[model samples]
Target: MVVAGRIHRRHFIIGAAGTAGAVVAIGANGVDAPALAQQTTEPQNGKALPEVVSWKDPDAVIVHTELTVETKRDKIGTSGITPSTELYLRNNLPSPSEEAVANRDSWEVSFEGVQNERTMTVGDLKRLGIETVAAVLQCSGNGRALFDHEASGTQWSTGAAGNLIWSGVPVRTVVEALGGVAAGRAFMTSTGGESLPEGIDPQTVIVERSIPADIAMERAILAWEMNGQPVPLAHGGPLRVVIPGFYGINNVKYVKKVAFTETESDAAIQRTGYRVRPVGVSGAPDQPSMWEMKVKSWVTHPLVDQQSGRIQIFGVAFGGNSAVQRVEVSTDGGQSWREANFVGPDLGSYAWRPFVLPVDLSPGTYTITSRATDASGNVQEEVTEPNHRGYDYSGWRRLAVDVTVT
Candidate 1:
């Protein structure tokens, strides 16, 4: 069988892993509850969801967009790094004018909460330093559609996530050069430069987020390049913020301003939008923010018909911030599992790992799934914890696919 035009070195499993059984409805009080009813949703509103002509991949799934796009699972081959042309698009606002991106070096970004506040051109930042890091760029609402309840917002599936390489100047490097962060800062807030439309309250929809200062200091960077190319206009060119380990919301696209604040930004997106509250509760500042990601893995290949014997199973596994320690795949719906082998070079802990498992099957029906464990020892959850917005769905249940072998 031609598997994405590539083959991997086989690493046999020493033994099988025991199953964790099927997911049953249980509440916080530890009482068995009835299952949440399945929900059906309507297409997103606004202008018709049109194809992104600029994107080279014809097979891309155009979910709901103000330019929102997703990579079809099968297209996410065994490669550890996702290509720039293949990356999913998740724009909150329209791209800046052609004039703004016409020249790459002249784009300006301002820095605040330092001993001195100042603005600099992208060309100027290129002179300070350069660093390259590979990371997962997943939408905060990536697995929304898999939730049993109607959690509102774009209904996304596994396609809404990808791992890519970023090149940029470290946030700490630039901050130190500007005489270091000013005292009393607890949060590092970043803002996008996209122009806001009229009639809407600017505070309600602006793409601004404030993450803990330590997170920003440790892994944040002012990225000018993605997947080795200059940042594109459609994908937050000529500059974006890369906050490794945090959800995509905190890595503001088209980042124009970076400031250190004593409190989180009061923007509605930060205070109310991405907050994770109980299914029926309203979002608030007191609720958990969709900041870091959880451990996730999903089957990607062999999603179609198979002919049984020696078939190879493929999927992706990653910890939101930590390195994945192992991935186990089961053909019997988690009743039994075999550890999978990692394919390709390790792209570092921030990126996802492509995994493969080989098994022989007779003609019949089967349900296949995969579960991941991170370096922190956090195992992928068997079910998503329902939230008001349906943020990150990392469970392997909905990720599984039914297959038939002739």
Candidate 2:
């Protein structure tokens, strides 16, 4: 009960040791806070974390489990940025200046607006077949830290988002090899960005758009490779656009052309300004705009700890079609709740699953909470509905820590 600078709610407890009457009946009863943490550490790979356990009774808690970092290279000058793949290669863009990345030898992939015109290459797209998906490419502002009111271009704090395996060729096999599309229409594509960083202008990089063409030809693709290789160039090299569930600004990068048309090309980045605020609507900041995606989660461990039940609680959860189903947890910050055990095999949709909760705390001063549910029923809403370009998703994410039972 000491809220001055924050971090103080009386703490510590995970039980069954000296059993002072079961730690006062489980501290008068209360425990449960999970659904995130543990995998993302690399003090140069020495690996030696775990020392954060606070308890004075905000509900005594501890969580430490996160370590996942790999390196690829080339995203910018100095190669600066690193926090588990730097927000999935700084959100993607670059490629398509009359395409010619030092000669992939001879590449081609044009397919103009519907019912005619076609073109292909890369060995005729590896013989016009070969598909191999595994999707997950988020960046609809990922979380933009609940927008915080304004000032952004990409300060991205929660590590953007990732998950791959993508192979390529689809957009309903290049809009049925460019000879189909009559009613209603939409599917313009036209990727390629990055070239504006120096002196800006080249028409500010160029990124086209258009959708609905039979749902963007059944979830676009064209991806030339990833998690396998040859797709580097800070990600999205040779060819891009996975669009599985949408986001990552419709997944168009370096792509080149796919058009199909029916008119709806406001040009990528969701029609010019990266858009937001249009879910339920709020003040009147000039309405009308769309491009959904608003569920997010990230807490990667204690970030700093001491002792208690040792500790363990991880992170990673995303949404579009959802599929987390359940993952509740609260260590006395949200009052009470339990259920944090989802290691893998849910594979529902929009990937990004990794969770852990194996604590034995009892030292005091805790605050952690994680909740999720998806599969269309959508249930991650604790409170977050007030847009104006804010773009924050279903809410409720409070994490604090400290412990030392001795």
Please give the lDDT score at residue 30 for candidate 2.
18
**After superposition, candidate 2 runs with Cα above 4 Å error:** 1-113, 116-130, 136-169, 172-176, 180-242, 245-295, 299-307, 317-350, 353-362, 369-406
Indicate the residue-level lDDT of 194 in model 2.
46
lDDT top scorer: 1
RMSD of each: 11.8, 19.3
lDDT of 1 at 367: 80
Clashing pairs in 1: 65-68
| lDDT at 47, model 2 | 36
TM-score, cand. 2: 0.30
Q: Write the per-residue lDDT of candidate 1 for residues 234-336, one digit (tens) a residue.
A: 7788899999888887888778899999999999999988898887898799988988999999887666656657777888899988999899999977789
Each prediction's TM-score against the native? 0.87, 0.30
